[model samples]
Target chain A: MTASRKPVPKPTPDTQPFWDGTAAGELRVQRCAACSRHCFYPRPSCPACGSGELEWITASGRATLYSYVINHRPAPGFEDDGPYAIAVVELEEGVRMMTNIVGVEITPENLELDMPLQVVFEKRGDMHLPLFEPTGAGL
Target chain B: MKDAVVIAGAAESDELGKLPHLSTLQLQLGSARNAMADAGLTKDDIDGVACVGSPIQIAHSLGITPAWLDGTGVGGSSFLFHVRHATAAIRAGLCHTVLITHGESGRSRVGAARMAMGPDSVLGQFELPYGVLGPTTTFTIPALRYMKETGLTHEQLAEVAVAQRRWANLNPRAAMRDLITVDDVFASRMVAYPFHLLECCLVTDGGGALIVTSEDRARALGTAKPLVHVLGTGESADAPIISQMEDFTSSKGFRLSSAAAFAEAGISHDDVDHVMIYDAFAHVPIYGLEDMGFLKRGEAGAFIAEGHTSPGGRLPLNTNGGGLSYTHTGMYGMFAIQEAVRQLRGEAAAQVPGAEISVVLGNGGMFASAATLVLAGHRG
Candidate 1:
């Protein structure tokens, strides 16, 4: 890794609870009370219905790889790593998110679209980043 | 408002590829001056200004002030939105003549604004912490999913570069002119998975500017430069982050923006004589071709690989080499607009014969926004 520090996510007043869930070993997303729909990357208003009434809920942590690119050029804190996979995964609740794929060799042969995966948190600076890995027993 | 606004002046910076000596402000002023000169006008003639950055600074630098100003900086496609906005402003009598300028030292990093995002911002909180780089990584994320669902092979993806190179070879100002095959593209350095270095756009230092005025004003001035009529314009936005996009296989912004432009132009797909889809990456045009209603899904791959968009083809595309082979200084929409005007005026280096109408499609911020323009040589 480069001597430069990695960027850390500073939670906002709206997103602090979501970050709190991650620190407690849970993946949390918002469910719009008005529309009864789930949303990721937690926000104040529902995208589907535009309602301000939202509730936090612990997610199943199950997802499938929707798409990704194996970046040959690593950002800071990934300099030591040769090439890494940055992915977007579709959750069981139908919302999609951006995350790093861990626990597998970064290659097209190893990573296929729609492959089963589960979220796992990794400590980065002061934040717990939710990274994904191939599904295994008890995941 | 059909043919009510005409492009009286358009020009790129004095030089495009690399200018380490030039600052961002210099690039902007240089191109702005060249465009005004091309229109046979002085600083006094320009009563309005528009650009991605502050219009006041540009106006003050040129010793001119105006009643109209637009600072719609929505990534590389901002210039297309400016063209569309200027058309509306001119027809509404809010501005007589509008000048849009774009300048960036992308490669040189000379006096360019630093890339910054708040830690609590949507992208900063969710995407950036995961080691997501700039466009090279994020913009390319959707290709694998698109390929899998549509059966678009890797070789076919490389064909996008090969086709544009053919057009680049015919233009002297193009940065990359040599003919390249699919094999050559694969042999090129890999920047991101499913995206070779050849498939990504160039990061060069350059700028471009445009001058839009009413048709009556052009007639009154009787300028010698050819006038390219603004037949239609449209603009729209989608999810800010790439992962939050409505659909992975297509772009909502592209579909909506292009449809509005076509509707306003009152022309069928058959009327378009030439095309320029902003190719920030090779897959972008594929998304554009299908989203813009030119072809059905799962068919654009074959259409491009078959040489339909190449030089001498029925629907010639990116005749000025595009951002891929030509100069792409950060915001590339201005360059795309410049090419359409050139083609319509029959003044392009790789001129298209009998071309009366041309369409330009632009994408901004990883499909986050889009704008489309339909232009013609004469009043239609």
Candidate 2:
């Protein structure tokens, strides 16, 4: 007998754009036109300058691992994905994104500050989530 | 602005750990009533009610329509924020007496529900995805980094846990009053690297409340001597996301908040006699002490090891056992203030000698929001 899989979170209206962008194999973040600063998590206005004029812009999909931790214990829904590497990626666009580090073994020996990375997508049914993988150190 | 004072009272429902008998509302009400009585006041006298994630609707259950109702839900720091808000309200004459309350069944309520964040919430989509479900795991990352940078050994961090537990033994209300040693801490199960199970704080079902009023009203009531004055209050926000912080090894919000508080109080870190720092995790106070200028940068481990923050040290901290061994009640800033008051009144179960000026530092949400409050006993 096989165990059933847990339900994945669906993208709500507030987060649909972000999920939609990821499904199209693109990384997009909200950029405030007034302040010309990029922001994350899709806000109506720029938190930096409080400008109401904001637009979604394609990102370089490149970043560095700012900080991370290897979760030894699995969450309830993510039992199969135990000991996953969760990271906070500082995007080249100057916005910090929380994503999982994939395509590499997560260990203190492997994980280092300012490690170069690039965005990748993992599909779960209709949803496509963005994950990051280490890229060779180069600008 | 007029002088705002903690004229009323403060109380906790229970110490840290599980409490199956009482509901969240019961704990809140119990602590609220105790605080009211401590201030020699009653429910009728309260004009404001503030809480974080309260099951009992504030105005309806508490039977008070506060002119100022702040249900700003910042875990562990909400009560301190409420105190700051209550002070402003009292100065503006909006309310004479304000009740700040909090309660949590953390042990039992774990994994019971999903958090719902508003669209404007910085954490709405940013944090939920990365499996940063709780504060403990998120905080551990930075703590581990701090240890690596400062050469802080596990034994040094364990000293904080052990010291707090020793203080807990003096208070009958404390939960984990059993003596814990540095060896016991290092030997405990590893919840996360650099954070043993003993190094973490208790997730308990408990509640706390504080009553705030004008200084004149406190003088009229005349219940307790050596009034603990709210000398100054300061609050600040760093990046909402833990990753965006300028420095993981330190708290910028603590520096900003403490600077403003000390300046407003017309005092320096050297003037502080004792401290009631929010100790949700052992590293919080370590970082807080450094950020508040109480200790030099990268010296918190040695500062704690040298017995500066221990009992009878230069600055005895968390004398009421703190959140580590005492009641956590979700947002623990109010309890820190409560402990500071107890020490000022010479009423703490583990009273620090000559504790006239106490500093209370509060951390609200994920090391993002912080508030500092200075309380001084009237010399006259």
What CAPRI class is candidate 2?
acceptable
lDDT of each: 0.90, 0.76
Clash count, candidate 1 = 0
**TM-scores for every predicted model:** 0.98, 0.88
Show the colliding residue pairs in model 1: none
In the range B79-120, model 2's lDDT, one tens digit per residue, is 777877888888888888788876666666632234555423
Instruction: Write one digit per residue (lDDT tens) for candidate 1, span B284-325.
Output: 989998998999998888889999999888888888888899
What's the distance in Å from true for residue A43, model 1? Answer: 1.6
For model 1, residues A15-77, the per-residue Cα lDDT tens digits are: 999899889989999999998899987888998999999999888999999999999988878
User: Residue B222 of candidate 1: its Cα lDDT?
Assistant: 75
Q: lDDT value for candidate 1?
A: 0.90
Best by TM-score: 1
For residue A96, what is the lDDT in candidate 2? 81
Question: What's the CA RMSD for each of the models?
Answer: 1.3, 3.5
RMSD (Cα, Å) of model 1: 1.3
